[model samples]
Target: MEKYIDIIKNSYSGYWRYLKHEIISVNHWDNYFYGLIIISVLVWVLEIIFPWRKDQAIFRKDFWLDTFYMFFNFFLLNLIILIALSNTVAAFFNDILAKIGLSISSFQLFDVDDLPKVLGLFVFFIVSDFVQWNTHRLLHRVPFLWNFHKVHHSVKEMGFAAHLRYHWMEPVVYKSLLYIPIAIIGGFDAQDVAIVHFFNITIGHLNHANLGWDYGILKYVFNNPKMHIWHHAKALPKHVRYGVNFGLTLSIWDYIFKTDYIPHSGKDITLGFEGDENFPKQFLAQELYPLNLNDKKK
Candidate 1:
């Protein structure tokens, strides 16, 4: 009977350990979802306190769009790529990126002896910022791409959903272009990549939100909701006004580059591409458009 007891105990121990590991892994992936839930709740609370827009639909139309985008970026993109591409075409590109000396693998560029989570986090954000900040600015300067990029600017209601009403091109550019440096260099771990996405996904929405949240120096330090809303502004000259708020998480580079703008009156601003007020805002139109600033229809 003692031997029988040991066998049962062993079976229970094996089953319990398997369950524990499963829980940890699930929490790791699902933590991103939890972060969104938590942030969204906080944002709702903030909307009541410091409202930014006058449009009623701001509340109605934008929440789901933002949620969809949050879902797409955190899970869909990661899952599809990891399953279909990351180890195949993706790995090839990563190696090529390493050869070119752009970004490094988390396993290689980082010192194995000792590494700081803070520094890794900082590098991840900065590198991604450098890529995105420039790409976003280009969409404004380049006439051809503005057609698709303008879909993001077409939003007038300014709500959480407004945050997600981007042209598919935006995500294409964001994931494909921005992640290039990260993928090629191979310098990040799964956790490092996860944190960067968390901040990018969260902060990007917050900056574009209709609800007001006082980030203050954080506004100056990093791109805030106000700063981003200004980027989408449709007003004249179509310059990158609040473009100074380029850094996704840190504005040191923006300040260094002298591109940061913080408006004085503290009012909600208009956003749209300068020339094409008639451009379509629908998904299909945005996918096919670029409002070529170079050649007018005449």
Candidate 2:
């Protein structure tokens, strides 16, 4: 009990310290706080200058809502709830593993640290993106998970900020699945590879933005706005039932696996699911949406 309490306390304290550093300190290139602001503003400016959906308002419907989700999911939620909770859970998991005498400390399949810096970063990026791709598919394929994922798909007007407008449970699902595979690639420094993280965020922002761009020849390699808009289309293709275009960062996975589907331009396509009109519009309600056991009990 004391150990758990210590873990919670440490998590809260650590989160505050990190948050303070991100706020008061200005590291320009390596700072996520500033990176988020800079990237968001840049993309938003692009949207204003060249919006594919010309009729959509500057402050589009649910624009503020999505912005709130961006900040909430990225920063506040960690401080308020998840940081401590995750630490406690992780501690418990480690204890269980210890009791079983199964050590994950040496789980690395190959040490990326031994390779050249660029090659190591490349390998780490590909493997991590692949993990996320599979996790994104699971969010669509699993019914219960889809309930939480609905918050993201509820977007009627796609924008840059809409990239982060997802249920908090999503990171939990994503990071939980991402842990082991990353552990397998020994000597992974998140700070050292912050560029890759930011790059993915940029791609995610573009994918959700109201822009029509498929990197021509590179369309098969990278996910672009044109290909991703269909992922949110109200109607799914007849051939693909679960969902399509499940790529998070790279389109390569979807193309290789045949999950990629962009039958039309998708610029004016209706976004959201069949019963989205009834989905919660507010942040708090959406956070609690998937776990609404009251509806299930009925």
Candidate 3:
């Protein structure tokens, strides 16, 4: 019991320390709080300067809502709930592993410790992105998961801040699945791949922004706004029921798996699911809506 109390105390302390470091005394370029702000402002400026949807307002529909979501999912939610829960879960899992005479470092697909730092980052990037890609598909295909993901699809406007406007449960889903392969290739922590993390944040923001840049020939490799807009289209191709363009940071997966779909320019397509009109518009309502989905279905 006291162990759990200590966990909560530590989690809160860590959260406060990070908040102060990120906001009050910003000292690092790579700190997520500052980095998120920098990348978001950068992409938003690009959107304003060269927007694909010229008629769209500078402060598009739900702009403030999405902005709140950005900070909530990135920081505030951790302070409220996730940090304590995650710490408890990790501690429990570690205890179970200890009972079995195994630790996280027990399994290794290969040793990345000796590899060049750049190459190691590359390897982690590839593996983790693939995990996220698969996880993204599951969010669509799984009914229970889709309910939670509906918070994100509720976005009617595309903007840089919309990139992080997802249900708080999403990180739980993503990190849970990403753990297996990452542990298998153990040698570095998330901090060690800060470059990849920031790069993905940039691409994610760019993918959701109201910009049409496709990286020209490199569209085959990285995700771009033109391609990703289709992923959010209100209508899906009849033959494909679940979703399309399941790529998180890379478009290569969609192309390779034949899930890529861009019948034409999707700049003007209506975005959201079939029943998004009934979805909650308020943040707290959206956060709680998924919990009631099964009850509604019954």
Candidate 4:
């Protein structure tokens, strides 16, 4: 029908507009690319100076695969998914809320726009981080979700580039879940979102890097490489929690949830999923591996 055809055309046009205005215009390409380079170089240097596993070479197994994952995630996959899905997802939640005679705006914590810039940034960071922490926990705890998450944990060696290595479905799920709560709290403008992403990128890289600093008391506050390394440990004792330390930027959530675990020395800790030594090493294989639901039984 002409009506359906017009609707399709209008939908495509709206999506393209959203991509241009919300994603492309707001994405500070210069800051993002340059910041990644600087942090990566810095982490690389630190890794060389203080290697976690002396036997491990700089170009260990699956190094290039993780590099591919990093580029694929940053330059292509995640960008397209976020641009395409964000608006529709928000609208879906808004519609559901409206049906119940409620709306996201009614749940607003405060006028986020009215707050000072610094304060607004802080509030956004805390709320977003909390959302991220729980989403991450769910990915590990939920059986079906762990299929996608396993691609990340399959990393044999952790490095700065490892930060961006994730299943493509992850961002879609994470951002969709995050959008409703964020919209309710008075959605963040592009600038606030950009700043939070910058911090996230920086901290994420450091958390997954090979460096060994634990930050003493500060480890209780912000997540560090040492703390996160344990998250990737190949095996934990039966008494020890399997999916411990599920924080993103801050370790406070793990502590509160009693999931935090850090050994006195990480040099002996093994990484990767147990009984997954035969896990596919190629990017394409790993992407498809999750879909083979039969593997989950094993």
Candidate 5:
């Protein structure tokens, strides 16, 4: 009982420290709130002016729930889970590497600062997107993983907030996988990572937004709303595979892998899983939805 009490106390203190150090000290909360406001206003305006589905309401079905998901993920889930997972992965890897007479501290592939900013940015973007692409594919292809991933796909209505409607465990899984590889490559410093992250967030929002725009020939390089909307299609065309268009920012991966599934028109497409009518519609329910062990039996 005393040990358990101590553990709880220590965990609370640690979290408080993290909240102070990582969030407050760095002004992450201010930046995130302001950035979200700016993007939200911009997307809201764009949606009103150039909606893909003219009949789609501004405050469509599940909009509030998705908004909750966005806040939950950005403020609580990501902060707690990502930091914990990052530390755990670092410690675990360090211990294993030490046993083998290797050290991440000594690992350096290139000096990122020495490279031109554009070149460094390009390399980070490509590598990170590749990692995310594979991870997204795995989430859809692996049945057990899809149970959690389905939370994101449960959104029947697409919007900017839909981009953030991911399961809480996803960032931990994706970021931990990304850390080791990026660490080894060594050229990407904090600024380079931040730049890639900014582009990723921007593109991710646009890809899910209801704005009716496909970059035409440039869609081959960058993912567009039209291309990504097909990914959420309730039932894909017969020719396309079960899970297609797993790219995050770049469509080049899908092109290379032959998983690109954009047709001449997406007019008839419907979003979300076919049998997801019973999926939870509230934030708390959705958070707990992934933990229901009975899902494995189905």
Candidate 6:
């Protein structure tokens, strides 16, 4: 027993050393999915007012599986943030700022260590959300991307898993494209980025919750779950039922694009595709099914 224990310890020690030099590390981003879990549940309770479908059911198995993936995506994204492009930009900024002056009396190099990271992440999230909102609308309008995107909108019933119901291509494409610009321009660290992802997942889940309650002015700056819930309504082009809120963080882009969708009006919206029989109910079918959208009007 002692020999085996020592062997295990030795192996772990070597692994730690390898990670220290060859691998980037992640911390301060553990259990990050808690925020998302709570919000999603709340939204579920309120889904009755503007459910994607009148018949949307809450399945126990689907609920847990979606929750599991929320945590999984959080952890996985945090891992990427730590190793790939967290502090490289910060170091670069510090070097440039140092050349100008440490404390030039009028203006210091920076307010604090984490200030730029905070502000930079805020801007990145809002901008990317705007991009996502429009891109989503375009996909629905166009034919090709909508096929895959329909995989997400095809869900007849929504729950916490509804947020994760997106076509797998979305995460790979959006994160890679947006993060690259953010890493280059904002000088974010892996830790800070992870924090943003943690918040984002939480908000996404909260938006998908079936809860009720109007958030008031908070709707202007942030895209609440209630507002986002209407987007996944699976149906399109309702009179006085479209156009109001369109952002996860900031409403600026939605306003600029003239595509901002807000449901501030008191019209009850029927969410989900209008008469969509091909929509899958099983969780595995949601993931395993090809993102291919068939023509000929389902």
Encode model 5's per-residue lDDT on 44-104: one tens digit a residue.
Answer: 7888888988888998777887787877787677455555555656667787899999988
lDDT of 1 by residue, 175-208 (tens): 6675556654445576666777767666766776
**Stronger candidate by TM-score (1 vs 4):** 4
- Cα lDDT tens digits, model 3, 1-298, are 7888899899989998888887976666668888888999999999999999999998999999999999989989899878887887778777789999998777777767878888889999999999999999999988889988988898998988899999999998888787768888876855778789899999999999999889999999999999999989999878887989989899999999999998999989999988888888899999999889563373
Model 2 segments beyond 4 Å from truth? Answer: 294-298
lDDT of 2 by residue, 18-70 (tens): 99999999955778888998999999999999999999998999899988988
lDDT of predicted model 4: 0.79
> In lDDT terms, how accurate is model 5?
0.77
- The lDDT leader among the candidates is 3
Better TM-score candidate (1, 3): 3
Error of 4 at 1 (Å): 12
Which candidate, 1 or 3, has the higher lDDT? 3
Q: Which stretches of candidate 1 lie over 4 Å from their true place?
A: 1-26, 54-114, 183-185, 236-244, 290-298
Candidate 6 to native Cα RMSD, angstroms? 9.9
Q: Scored by CA lDDT, what does every candidate get?
A: 0.58, 0.88, 0.89, 0.79, 0.77, 0.53
Superior candidate under TM-score, 1 versus 6 = 1
Error of 5 at 158 (Å): 0.7
- Comparing 2 with 5 on TM-score, the higher-scoring candidate is 2
The candidate 5 region of ten consecutive residues with least summed lDDT is: 22-31
lDDT of 6 by residue, 82-129 (tens): 223333433444556688874122242333234565576776666567
- The estimated TM-scores of all candidates read 0.69, 0.95, 0.95, 0.86, 0.87, 0.60
